[model samples]
Target: MEPVRLIMSGAVVGQELAAEFGPLPPSLLPVGTQRLYELQLAALGGTRQHLVLPETFELSAFDRERLVELNVEIAPIPEGLRLGEAVVYALNSIGAGDTPVHILHGDTLIAEPPLSEADVIVGGRRSNEYAWAEIDTDGEGRITALVDTRAGEEGREHQPVAAGYFAFGSAVDLLRSMTRMRGDFVAGVNHYLAGHSVKLARGGRWLDFGHLQTFFQSRLAVTTARAFNTVRIDGLTARKSSQDEAKIWAEAHWLQEAPPAVQVYCGRLLGFGAEDGKSFYETEYEYLPVLSELFVYGALGRQPWLRILASCEDFLRTCAGITGSGSGDAALKALAADKTLARLERFARETGFPIDAPLSFEGRACPSLVSIAERLVAAYDLQSGAPESVFHGDLCFSNILYDSRVRRIKAIDPRGLVGERPTIYGDLRYDLAKLAHSVVGRYDQIIAGRCRAERHGEDFSLAFEPIACQPWLEAALGDLSVRGVGGLSPAVRAVTVSLFLSMIPLHADKPERQKAFVANALKLFLQMERQ
Candidate 1:
């Protein structure tokens, strides 16, 4: 079969969404590690796909290059054109002659689509959502008609809605029908169906992101995260851009500001600048498997996890050696002690958490939340001169990426702040605590919503999703707990437990996660007290 001439039209980003995410086409929104359009192109099984984008939506250089890498021909169209007219305009714009034309809406994705050699098949999703065209079918379940709900409501109850994937045998016939329909895209589709025996291909795996609620629903279903900045990535480069001057400026300057010996472990910085009033920077985006996802979800055996831990430890130790300092006694105390307590108190006030009362987790009685914070803060009295280092302030598992072929790991997204200022140096124990929270506290699992945390009176129950690699995780945790790499101090446990509590306010949107954070902190705190 000859390759289908594919054209995808992503719904133009609306004002509300553009205001928050900065004019990103819904197709380009990050889903997991890749963009929605990248996933669409991969699943739709098209060759040299053409993407129709609003001409005014100024294509970011990184996004244009990324789309070009996927062989997507950029067919820029004027804004305000009707969906049908726009699609037809895109088809007429392309030079392919008499080939099969496959049209897909960028916001829709189907897993394992039945891309059959049928003369006409239109994609439908099982949704009662009014945004989609209500599909009508004959006795044999062939698509007979469509009721576009955008005009008026019809019998759209739990029916297959035209969620926008179509494969027509002949582009010439499609153009003839669509051209006459003009701005009425649904009418054009119906006109074509009237002449052809159209098949309804409801792949059951249909995902839609056409509206505000559905967009986030589908996005969360695919993956998650980040608020201060927006990150765009191609195969070779990542650009983290934000209007927040302090955050972007610090991150963009990190490569140069970092200690020379520690700089080698990070992704190479390409450049940094302000564009359209937003601060932005670029870095080499060498795709590596994220360490957190691999440890928990990859189902790897003991040796693989061990090697990962070893490589990570080596990397951290090398940086620690290059970064150790005896300074910043006051700032370290203020950031870890005062800032943490402030955040924890804010969490209590926000969630009505009974911080003053003693709490228990898994039946183990523990100190009041405030008392725990005080103890942890007391432990971090840097006046005694614990060694500080130029550190990745937020060195959680998610930020560390590993390439198995080369047995190397590279880190990204340094916290880049200490106390009230932006800097590279902090207590090295804090960095270890960051890594420890991943191994022992299972911080990633909580963020992924794979853990359970339920409250009953003053007691709580918390359990991470069961994993086959739990034993290996336990083993690794024990090894790290006893004698941390680079002559670590026992203060890591205090800092790690405190971290779970202090971070609760940051994820205020996830109430269950906030509860989980409290529960995890109590669990880790009780364990530390017993030890």
Candidate 2:
């Protein structure tokens, strides 16, 4: 028996897509570490392929090399031909004579391939819109009539639509079907089903990403699932994007060997529940053992505050020890040149505030404050000409869990690396800056919605629930000053203060609180400058 040949059709120039992203080939549209066409190829288990291109298509050298690697033959359809005619033209060029062939659309993303052993296999998904497939299946799961919507009102009732995946036992039959398909080669698969016993496959998720909106949606779904291993639970209010917190909970089972007892309940994923179009990461239903958040506990007493500080100190020291090697200069450049500062300017415009101007804190505006802050940070590099180590990317108070029973503090939701790059050991200063927010910047209260900004034209006054543990803040700063990198310098203070400012544009969930954080950080910067 001859090996199956995969034929992919993506030759047409999507006019709207061309006007925006570029008039590039559809298969080259990027998604997660590879092109969309590469992903489609990966989904199929064929060694040989025939990829059809448009008459006006131009292949890049890189793409050509990739085609050579994949054992693919490029077949360009001529101008002024319908899709069916183009497909026929490509097939005739290959002289695909009676070999088993699989037909696929390049613009679609399939989560998994439908495996089948039959004369013909047609991948169909439940859909109300687009081409509908009226499938008459026998008790043995063999399709009798694969009627298209063009078959009139009776055929329109087909609930499962063929969303661009077809298989044939013989290319001779497929060629005959292509001859019959006068137009719209995609929908033409319906005509090809006449005489062949078709198997309707509903094996995995199928998404049509031909349009811009659906393309983004499909990308988000695929990437999110890949990153978080999302498992939506029933009767829970968790969203797909909010699975980071759940990930911490789910991963605790593996990360729970060390002391401090981070999670009270950690276990394997039981199962996910998807109802009403909402999903939740399903784990064994158990209450998280949290007496109170470290923020609330710190506000209650001085001893609790000290304990939280010590716990955080210990946890950070542990993280700092898990070091690795990378270019310190490169990491510092990435951090210092992060686009948050530009976004800060945009945020000022959108919120009608002068973020660049001196902020009024404790009834006084420090002279040349924003300029001074910028100069101090700009003059110094956080990496300090040495490779740094792993640090919790977001060690804010909200991310810290204080188990008072064990008198231990735990951190959650490490901001991992940026993109596919290992940003894990970029700079220790970023982590220190975030940690400082809880003490000097009053981030705990700010996150709890106890922050507000009063704007008067070009000036603004910010108010936040005052940070109560000044001595604890001083001690923590002092400890970090002695042990952390870029130690206790003017640059360190500026970076810490700037972290708060940088965070203001990030919190779309609570803009008022972010403004307050900025104010608090500004006040700290003024004090540091005066010293």
Candidate 3:
């Protein structure tokens, strides 16, 4: 079949033409220049002819040159002619008797091939506004109406078929009919076809670059289609120009601020390490410390006063305790057998801490420790069971922030059941044990480093040395007779050891390492039982 001749007319012909005239170098074409060069190549493939009309530019040297090169003809319509009229004039000048003319508006860019079977092809719905409305029908899909308007409706109910491109069997007949009707060529064609048989071809992807917004939108679409990776540093500037003022302001004001790095880093590490160790350890590990520093500064170090008060409260309320109604000895035996206490005892043993060793009954391991903790609670109960309170369930170097400038330790990341003085006393030793275990291997190094850095280095380590668990344990558990709890400390130690042992599985790369960690934790637990 002979190729179809494409004709286009519009006001912004210069800017919108190349997008429609496929495969032409944008830089080579002049404003308002007919892209006959590209059309000639397309004609060689199958298209028959091409034509363009710029209402203002009548006959130019560029037009004549393009006409000669394209082996086509040109006609200059008078000024003040509408695009539809100019299209009719161009169709007539080309001798409509010989070939089928395909009329396309300059603003439309064809991204796909035209239909081969249809005499008239139009683009499909490209936006929500132009969506086809479905009618409630009894039968399968059929074109029931060219246009339908409901009562009191402001607009037509049928889908709006855009008149961007259309072809006719007889160009002259169509043009003459359009001229006689005194209407736009599209309306004229639709009117002529009011009674005639016509077929509708499904449309392809057609982009309209008519307005400034659509022009940029189309450009962005094209860039995305071509997979061009373009980055703009001023995203807000581009967004503002695109008329998203709210988003522009939001991004400028809120989302651009620096985030807490430590939390971000730790969260990432936990997620990544759990999900993909090869990826996390090899690629993401180096950046963890840097991000963690931000968290330390912002959340941990900056908020010491809050941490200290909270820690003290938690210590008073959850860590101290009391024997309920039973014989203090029996209660102490049960406490010693408790799994949580056994775990702590095991933890002390595996980590090489003195908390797991046999005690001389009166110290921390004695039954009196529980009675003492309870008595401390009873004292508070006498004073209406209220005391200045705060608590950090997990109090340790990991959760505590040491402010070098102020020489104060701040606690963080509190957890556990918080309540009155008795309840707090019940969980006191657990917190202390947790703190002591956390500072095991590196406590001296950290204290020495801090002391050396202080200007008034009046043996700061001495003050911290007194706070260690050994003295506290000895004072609390001195003799076996008064030891209120038979195996409470050992049980707590076992639980702590089990938890630390479980952590090894998280960082262990080898199965043997994990097995070893578990075996060692079990041995520690058994030792707690013996104690």
Candidate 4:
């Protein structure tokens, strides 16, 4: 079967959504980590697609870059034309004459795509709430014609309407029909049907993102409505952008220059540049869930969690194998000692955290935050005399995604710095500590705002949503500990405490979150002191 190119009619102006979420097209509304258009591309599954735009619909730099990253070609047409005219004009302007093309509405996602066996397929569903093309069928149950509901009702009510997907045997017929209908989308379809037999495909999961409620609901169901990180994925490309240029550039560099052994575990960098003054980089995106979600979603009763841990262990071991032992103090000083101290000071200044006072929390006597951090830094210095391999500065469940179909985990958001330099080599123990910080320190829970901190000056109490998979997670961390991984390793354990304390400054917008980070750090520090 010859392949057909997809033409996404996405230039439809989203007046309501624009007023709510700014000037993003309705198609760009993010569901999960990817935009709605990315979901359409995934369902359609094509090498390339076209985004036909109204001439007045200007794209933001991020949107423009994302379209390019997804291999989607853009075609803008004159404004105020009917849908049929706009589509045909876009095709003609892009020089796609007479080619087999599948036209899908920007706001629609058809789970079951068009059947290529039929020369013409009109996807319809039994719904008339929204303005759509009314499907008219013959007595023999074949599609005979379509009427534009928005133009005039014409007494068509409660009939199967277009779900916004159309397939044609040839684009030439569409152009000729549109020419005859004078730019009426439904009329043009009916004109084309004078000779062509139309196949009616009904009853698949069709998602319409045009409505505000449905759009927000769908976006919430897949993932949080708000992004916890700067990474955006379209299942084809993942872009990590930040105002911090050096950090983003180093990440791209690490992925590109990664040793061949672990390169397979990294997102393949596609392109990178500064867009509108923000540094950004793109990599191939996948639809896999982050390990944090699966760890909590536990539908399979620990089997999936066990496999995820195994995959994570394999990844960490591979990273640890990248280099032999160096003196290790330089990386320790840069990544751990200096960074943790600096971050702790900032956390104190920003949050007025009692970092310089004696504290007793979670039933353990503790010194000031700065004192314990210094001691922990010394402890790491003594225990990490012979480092095993290079490090990924941030190695947590949120930064790692698992491909369950393949039983492998891929990593993203490498810290990309060993010490002062943005290089790929750092202390492997720090990486181990990071992975442990998520499990042993419960960092994901804190980030999700599930944790609470009750503080009375130097004393504090804390709690978070109980992890149902705590037993399994603890067992996995224990296994890593038994194998000399970081969870229970004295040096790595100290670094994990430092991680929790040092990261408090980053979540400045959420004072509650910062306090939780501080409490979690205190809890970990008390445990480390007992050891």
Candidate 5:
């Protein structure tokens, strides 16, 4: 059987309908009413649909553009008296000859299931008995005459009720009747349907978005969906090339972007150099590609190195010290702080994953973890007055990316402000924590695989080593001190231990990796306590 042909009317019928219904009352409408038509279309497999709207109804340019993008056919009808009459006339003009047409309002989005053999299917809630008439009933509790009781309740003493939708078996006939009846169009259609047997299909949520309040609520719903699901391939690809590219894209286009001071602070902390002498726009353009690639690849599970790089970049930025001040600035700062860790934590909790257990360190603990912890405490103890610089307060895995092809790393999303040098010095341990957690958590599996692969003595570097981690950490920190934020070791041992402890559960899959993380965290905590 062919897909059902859907015709939508009443694009802005809600405004007038709501006014007619009386004063606006606040209430949470159904979720279906608040979602955008685009998302509804996606849910129903986009195909075989036509939308009809009156010219009087004002639709945003963006909405129109979106309709076009979704390949929806839009037909404009003359606006004036009996807008419903105009819509029926348009549907009759365009529908397939004599075919049963499914008519719905623009605000009503339905999830399309395979069509049943019934001649006509009308959907409504069984609970809305007063507003709906049970014309026919099967032996079972099934309903058949669920015709719209909208007009009956409209201006009545009872609470207002509406079917908000209708379906017709005789599309051509309904159109003709609508044109002739004009002002009495809806009544005529109901009269016509009364003579014919119509099947009532119960189920599906209904939303009425015919008011300013409903419209506002619907906008928020749409924004939430766009923020989470919208994909920008170009933006993602661009970020992989450079840190600046990712920063620009995240700040300017991505729903998340850090504030200017925070952005500057992050850069300084991460050893991105002073924003004073640099071209901000140029730097962002250069960085976006790198950041994008790192994010996409990391998400794809193609590169493990990104775990360290991203952590390091973000840590450095946060240590530098970029803070949120005003509303706009706060928004930017939040944008820069990558919330991946929080997201992962939530996901793990929801999925019932054990994420709060202590990690098991193998026979040997990471020496670097101890050394880094001690150094951090010493730096913090000195109370060295470091120059104020910018920082990405939430430096975590999600904000950083590592490009395997170039063997380079980049950072995106920054938060606080600090001296450039101090930011770098303090942030060095972040990457080490990430690496240790990953290696310790996944240690057994990685080692097993490496051992199997190197049975014939082939090279393998799957192990996590303090020796390897230290170089990158030191280099990044040193660069920040020398070129960006003034050199002041602001590294806090407590923060380092906390970071390591957080990663323990994430590395649960690898016992050795898990162990390493625990060992490191314990050592760091001990060092901090001593200091």
Candidate 6:
């Protein structure tokens, strides 16, 4: 059968839920990386689909632009329609002929494909909570009559409820019949039920994300599904890893070439894991790519290394302004108040390093470690917040893979969270801090257990052999400043300090490494103060 035109009616989704996450319309609320409307379109599996909206609804420029990107055609319901009449008006406006039209509620999420052999199929599920649609089906499962079961309807408790999914073979006749009946689509369906043959598609996984409770629950469910799925690609085993890695793998393929200008040498998505919980999607493995940590530790030219950082920034800048991501100011305040500093202080005390011990960098005695930490936290708290962008949460040198022959940089293991939530909006300063740790903080050596910290009388010192990325690092900073991607030096420094401090808790079992990270953060805080 030919593909049908999907009519997604968002007019009935209501304004209360549309503005739940922010000012974002219901259609734009993010499910994973994509939005609710985008997911529906993907489920329909066509080039484009029809999006129906209320006549009074005004589309934001961003939303309109995104709809254009998705190749969606908007159809609006006429103004001054009664409750439930808007969907019928919108449907009648389609001028449906012989072609089948699939009607779906925009707020609902149905994972199963629109696969049905019957001329008309109404998706439903048997549940105790819902006002069940008591479906009377024939021997072939063709629905005879749909009865709405209410609380007082004693015997209809075990019936299947219609989930707002329908397929119509003759849209013109059905819509015309609905206009005469003057009711909701389901009411209209019930009005013409005697003549048309309707099939019941029952027991499919579905969710109506209209209110806050259902939306949040469905969001978590989708996130969990996105997090852990198997991947299968030819000549490669997609091993199960963190959610961040899986998202990065999918994103890398979406962006076939790394931005600014470099090829992305990462796996391509093939689907779910063949081995249970091992992976989410598989991809064709690129052979002989050098892990960037090994490449950076080796004899690499400064220009190529600088190019990778520049290209990374280019990619990040393009992915800004995702809807429902939290405010930057709030996130920065949370970061400053996070338990990382407390953990660092504990590690310092356990390692026999006094918090009030004099800290010196470049032979200049400045403030004590405790004083520096307090000042930095205070400074971060006073900040106005940085501009948000799509950041590789862990952009350390190790997560990058460089193909020497192809001259590409494939980034792996993205953090996928903005603030405490899984979102794409994050302060660029966080990413900058991560990259800076590899250069100035010597995070790689610290992780390798090569970093050492010592207490001499009243002074504490940290020592680590530096890598050869200094010249490139300088170039990167200059590029960021020139390109206006740099937020503020003080904010970046505060974030960098937090980055090192946060590592202390991550290495709690390794007291030596924890001490080194604490010392590193203290030194960075002091340097920021000097600056």
Which predicted model would earn the best TM-score?
Answer: 1
> Least lDDT summed over 10 consecutive residues: which range in candidate 2?
285-294
lDDT of 6 by residue, 476-517 (tens): 664574124463366667777877765565566777776677
Taking the tens digit of each residue's C-alpha lDDT, what string does model 2 give over 175-199? 7776776755644555666667677
Please, what are the lDDT tens digits per residue for candidate 3 over residues 1-531?
A: 353565464333333332222222221221111222342333223435555544354443433564566665444455456655766666666555645556655555555435453345453443433322222221432222234334334443444455365655666566766787573654566554554344554454555554333443444433211111111212112111113233222222221221332122111111111121111111111101111111111112223333343333333333233223323222222222233344444444454433322322211132211222222222111222222122234454444433333433433323322221122112333444344333321232221221111111111111111222334332232221112221135434443443443344242334333333333333334444466
Candidate 4 lDDT tens digits, 169-273: 777888899889898878888888887887777635777777654554344334542344376656467677878888788888888778877877777789999
Native-vs-model 2 lDDT? 0.56
- Against the true structure, candidate 5 reaches a TM-score of 0.36
Stretches off by above 4 angstroms in model 4 are 1-232, 297-300, 324-326, 481-486
Q: Which 10 consecutive positions of candidate 3 have the poorest summed lDDT?
A: 282-291
Sort the candidates on lDDT, descending order: 1, 4, 6, 2, 5, 3
Worst 10 residues of 6 by lDDT: 224-233
Q: Estimate each model's TM-score.
A: 0.60, 0.45, 0.34, 0.60, 0.36, 0.46
> Model-by-model lDDT, in order?
0.71, 0.56, 0.36, 0.70, 0.39, 0.57
Ranking 1 against 2 by lDDT, winner: 1
After superposition, the stretches of candidate 2 with alpha carbons farther than 4 Å from their true spots are 1-292, 297-300, 355-363, 366-373, 419-423, 466-470, 480-489, 508-511
TM-score comparison, 3 vs 4, better candidate: 4
Superposition error at 124 for model 4 (Å): 7.7
What TM value does model 2 have?
Answer: 0.45
Which should have the higher TM-score, number 1 or number 5? Answer: 1
**Residue 50, candidate 6: C-alpha displacement in angstroms:** 73
RMSD of each: 16.8, 20.5, 27.9, 16.8, 19.8, 21.7
Cα error of candidate 6 at position 252, Å:
12
lDDT of prediction 4: 0.70
